[model samples]
Target: EPEVTQTPSHQVTQMGQEVILRCVPISNHLYFYWYRQILGQKVEFLVSFYNNEISEKSEIFDDQFSVERPDGSNFTLKIRSTKLEDSAMYFCASHNARGGTGELFFGEGSRLTVL
Candidate 1:
């Protein structure tokens, strides 16, 4: 079976620096999403992309954040600046266009740590 894949499983950056997390979902999937977990907190949705545009976004996706499907296969999330509070496990997910309310297959996650 195929699955979502993320690069640089772990990232450590200084406060105020920028970071970009990358992901590759199954080729046949139609929806892409980004979610984050702050340590023990529940996973929170950041944004959802469909048809190459943002379909939905949460308050967490402020001006300082952005997502792009630079190429047909790769999806990326860029953060203009980092803060200690930004440290979390970022997960990349995707869902097929078939019959279903909404079901996502997620990546292992890219852990970001800000110092």
Candidate 2:
């Protein structure tokens, strides 16, 4: 079976520093997304990417946040400046198609900690 993979499973950074989380989604999947969970809170959608462009984005995905498929195999999320509130578990997700049973494959998540 295939699954999404994330790098730097855990990261600790100072406030105002840049952070980049990396992921490798399933090769066959067509849609990619980035989500986050602030400790003890509901999962929040950040952004969705497809056909090499952003499909949709939440307000939480402000100018500080960006997502990219730099190559055919890797997807990445970058935060230009980290804040105390930015600490959370960032997840990478994917689905092969859009109109199915709404099943999504998710990565283990990269935990970000800002001091």
Candidate 3:
């Protein structure tokens, strides 16, 4: 069985530094997304990418954030300037199709810590 994979399971950074989170989704999946959970907060949808462009994004994905599928096999999310509020567990997910009954495969998540 295939699954989403993320790198650098935990990262510690200073406030205002840049961070890049990477993900490799299931090979057959087409839709990819980034979500985040801040400590004890609920999970929040950040952005969804498909066909090499953003299909949907939440307000959280603002000027400081960007996402890209750099290659056929890898997807990445970048935060230009991290803030204390940016500390969280970032998850990567994928599905064969959007808004379908098909389940999504989620990565273990990359935890970002900003000091």
Instruction: Name the regions of candidate 2 deviating beyond 4 angstroms.
Output: 98-102
- As a whole number from 0 to 100, the lDDT of residue 103 in candidate 2 is 82
**Candidate 2 global CA lDDT score:** 0.96
Q: What TM-score does each of the candidates earn?
A: 0.96, 0.96, 0.95
Error of 1 at 98 (Å): 2.5
In angstroms, the error of model 3 at 57 is: 0.4
Q: How far is candidate 3 from the true structure (C-alpha RMSD, Å)?
A: 1.6
lDDT of each: 0.95, 0.96, 0.95
Off by over 4 Å in 1: none
Pick out the ten consecutive residues of candidate 3 with the lowest summed lDDT: 96-105
* lDDT tens digits, residue span 1-115, model 1: 9999998799999999999999999888999999999999999999999999999999999998999999999999999999899999999999987887668999999999999
TM-score of 2: 0.96
The window of 10 residues in a row where model 2 has the poorest summed lDDT is: 95-104
TM-score winner between candidates 1 and 3: 1
Lowest lDDT sum, 10 consecutive residues, model 1, at 96-105
lDDT of 2 by residue, 1-115 (tens): 9999999899999999999999999988999999999999999999999999999999999999999999988999999999999999999999988577658999999999999
